[model samples]
Target chain A: TQLLEQSPQFLSIQEGENLTVYCNSSSVFSSLQWYRQEPGEGPVLLVTVVTGGEVKKLKRLTFQFGDARKDSSLHITAAQPGDTGLYLCAGSVGTSGSRLTFGEGTQLTVNP
Target chain B: DAGITQSPRHKVTETGTPVTLRCHQTENHRYMYWYRQDPGHGLRLIHYSYGVKDTDKGEVSDGYSVSRSKTEDFLLTLESATSSQTSVYFCAIARGLAGGGETQYFGPGTRLLVL
Candidate 1:
């Protein structure tokens, strides 16, 4: 089983601040995905990184996959109150469509 | 978003009782998953089905079982409900992502409490 360790388990910052969360693992992954979950709702996919050393951006947010394919990072710039949520990183070896193994999660709180 | 519905969105059952949670997807997705969410544990997969009648266990599969008789429905059963099982349960359907592997679309989630 692949274990993903997420750093900065809880972070709180004022609006307009910048923050970065990391996901690291000892096992290589075929794909890694980032998801955000709001209170009372299931998680929503933010981005998927399949290639090592790849960088993908969604407005104000950037996701990077490590060169070794064993880690990833999510950076948020100019965060807003709406950006406060639970951020989860899931990795899959994809050897039989194995269900993703999730990180402990980083809880972000952006205050206005 | 694929139309996914989980029955008994809120359930309160007694320990040692059998409880079933149903997940229905209108998109006929090939993959469906059942996961449990806890405070520190995040979300852990309980079971997953690749296709009709084809299912497999995940990292945390004990005390839970799943069945998929049709492509549109996946059922998760707790043979005997326990306090450890009281948590928000989420069902997700996996569909191909534009660039790679698969992306999962989740339901609103079902909250269960075992006393």
Candidate 2:
């Protein structure tokens, strides 16, 4: 089983502060994705990095896939209260439609 | 926005009873998956299907069974409900859209409380 471990399980920061969440794994993946989930709602995909050392930026958020494809990072710039939610990273292995293994998640709390 | 919907958004059931959760999709995607999330366990895969009548066990397949009789529907059944089975259940679908982020879309989720 592929496991993705996330760090700083819980984060509390004031609005406008920047934050970065990490997802580490021992197994390689074909692609890595980032998602933001709010309470009572399903997760919404933020970005997907398919190539090793690939980087994708979505407005205020930047996503990076490690060169080895075994890890990834999500950096939120000028974090706002709207960013407070559960951040999860999922990795796709082999085929494009293969099952994705997700990280435990990082709960971000941006205090306004 | 994966056009996925999970029924029985919230349910409470007694132990040793059968419970089935339904996931419906309108996107016509070929892949569907079921997962459960706990406080510290993030989301763990229960089962998934690649095509109609083609299914496989996920990491946490024990005590759970799933069926995909049609391309649009997936059913997850709890053979015998247990308290430890209490968690938020999510149904996801893969779009595989070109240039679209290769991420899964989740349903609103079903909150099941087992006694």
Candidate 3:
């Protein structure tokens, strides 16, 4: 099984600050996905990166996949209090039916 | 918000008791998954179904079993609940895609407490 290791397990920042969370793995994956989960609710898919060195932006959030397909990162610009949540990175290998391997997650807290 | 719902949103039970959790989706997706979320452990897949009556175990499948009789419903059961099983459970549905690009929509999740 592939294992994803997330850095900065916990982060606390004031509103308007910027932060980046990293997800690293020794194994290569076909795709990498980012999800943000709020308290008391399940995770919601934020984005999927299928190509190496790919970068996608969602408003103030930016996601990037490593050129080696063994790492990914999520960067939030001008973070707001609403951005606080648990961020998870999942890697998928092989075909679509393959299961995803998830990282422990990064708990982000953007204080007002 | 993919029309997925989990029954018994909050459950409290004792050890050695049998417990069942239900996941129902209205989107008629082809795949469904059951996962458990624990502190510092992230979400670990327990079981997944690709089609009706076709199921497979995941990374953390011990002590749990799943059954799917219809495209919209997946059931997960714990034969004998244990304290280690206390955690929030989530159900997800996805329309399978190639190259593992499919996005999974999750339900609200069910919080289970085992005493």
Candidate 4:
């Protein structure tokens, strides 16, 4: 089974602070995706990185895929209260790439 | 936002009761999945279907069963509810097979509490 482990299970910061969440695994993946979930709602996809060392930016959030395809990271620049939520990383593995293994997730709270 | 909806948004039931949750999608995606989320466990797959009458177990499938009798409807059933089964269940649809880097769109989620 493919497993993704996330660091800093919980985080709280003042508005304007920068934070980085890490997702690591021993197994390689064909592609990786990041998701953000607010309370009482299902997760919303943030971005997907398909190539090693690829980086994608969405407004204030930047997502990076590991060079080895075994890890990924999400960085928030000048985080605001709106950025507060649970961030999750999921990887697509196996021969068919038909399944996604997700990380436990990091909860972020940006206080205004 | 991908035309996915789950019925009985919230349900509370006693132990040993049988419960079935319904997931309907208007996107007509070919792949559908059932996942349960809990505090400390991000999301664990319960079951997934590649097509009608074609279903398979997932990582945590022991207590749950699923059926896809049509293109747009997928149902998850709990034979005997237990308190340990309390969690937020989500249904997702993807246009193509997973692992191909296809984006999976999620529903609003159904909150189930087994008393």
Candidate 5:
């Protein structure tokens, strides 16, 4: 079984602060995805990174896949109250099918 | 946002009782997944269906069963409820074409409490 360990399980910051969460694993993945989930709702996909060293930006959020494909990071610039949520990273080994494994999750709270 | 809905959004049940959660999707997606989310555990896959009447167990499938009789509806059944099984359950649909790297859209989720 592959495990993805996420750092800084809990985070609290004032609005406009910048924060970065890291996801590390010993196993390599073909693709990695980031998801954000608000209270009382399921997770929503934020971005997907397929190649090593690839970076994708979504408004204030930026996601990067490691060069080894065994780790990833999510950076939030100028965080806002709406950026507060649980962030999850999932890794997929197979090129097809539904065999994705997810990290524990990073709970972020951005106070206005 | 994916047109997925789960019935009995919140449920309270006793131990040893059978419970069934229903997931309905209007997108007619070919893949559907069931996952459970806990405080420290983000989301653990319990089961998934690739097509009508075709399903498979996931990482945490013990004591849980799933059936997909039609394309739009997938059902998850807990044979005997256990306190350890109490968690938020989510239903997701894969919106990408066959093969991997597809984005999955999730339903609001069903919160279950077993006492």
Candidate 6:
């Protein structure tokens, strides 16, 4: 069984602050994805990193995949109230018929 | 908004009762998936269907069953609901192939409460 672990399960920060969320796993994955879920809604895909050491940016968000493909990170610059939500990291083994193994998620609260 | 919709967005039922959730899509995607989200667990796959009348169990499929009789609709059934099964259910669809890193679009999700 593969598991993805996320750090800082809960985070509360003021506006304009910078925050980083980490996702790590012991098993290697072929691809990793970041998703943001608001309250009472389904998760929305933020980005997908396929290659090792890959970095993708979405506005103020920066996502990086580790060189070993066993970990990933999401960094938000100048966080705002709109950034408050649950952030989840999911990985695909590439051999499990494209099924994704998800992390526990990081709940971020950006106070305005 | 990938043309996916889940019915009965919120449901409350007694334990041991049967419940069914519906997922409808307009994109005619080849793959459809069911997942449940909890407080500690981000999202766990319950079942998936590759095509019409073709489905398979997922990581947490013991208490659930799924059916895909048409290209646009997939149904998830809980024979005997349990309190432990209360969670938010989400339906996702993939447009292209199944294992090629295709992006999946998710529905709004259904919140089920088994008391």
lDDT of 6 by residue, B1-115 (tens): 7899999999999999999999999988888999999887789999999899999999999999999999999999999999999999999987543445666678999999999
- Candidate 4 residue-wise lDDT, A3-108, digit = tens: 9999889999999999999999999998888999998898998888888999999999999999999999999999999998999998887434177899999999
* Tens-digit per-residue lDDT, B17-71, candidate 4: 9999999999778889999999888899999998999999999999899999999
Off-target runs (Cα >4 Å) in candidate 1 are: none
Q: How badly does each model clash, as a count of residue pairs?
A: 0, 0, 0, 3, 2, 0
Give the CAPRI rating of model 1.
medium
TM-score, per-candidate, Cα-based: 0.97, 0.96, 0.96, 0.96, 0.95, 0.95
RMSD of 5: 1.6
lDDT of 3 by residue, A1-112 (tens): 7999999899999999999999999999988889999999989999989899999999999999999999999999999999999999999886556688899999999999
lDDT: which is higher, 2 or 5? 5
List candidate 3 segments past 4 Å from native. Answer: B96-100
lDDT of 5: 0.92
Superposition error at B13 for model 2 (Å):
0.7
User: iRMS of every model, one decimal?
Assistant: 1.7, 2.2, 1.8, 2.3, 1.7, 2.3
Query: How far in Å is the alpha carbon of A99 misplaced in model 4?
Result: 1.5
Screening candidate 6 with a backbone cut-off below 3 angstroms (N, C-alpha, C), the clashing residue pairs are: none
Candidate 5 residues lying further than 4 Å off, grouped into runs, are B97-100
Q: After superposition, how far is residue B71 of candidate 1 from its true place, in Å?
A: 0.6
Better candidate by lDDT, 3 or 4: 3
lDDT of 1 by residue, A80-102 (tens): 99999999999988834557989
Residue pairs in steric clash, candidate 4?
A97-B98, A97-B99, A98-B98
Per-residue CA lDDT of candidate 5, range B30-82, in tens? 99999999987789999999999999999999999999999999999999999
* Docking outcome class, model 2: medium
Task: Give lDDT: candidate 4, residue A66.
Answer: 93
* DockQ each: 0.67, 0.66, 0.71, 0.61, 0.70, 0.60
Candidate lDDT values, in order: 0.93, 0.91, 0.92, 0.90, 0.92, 0.92
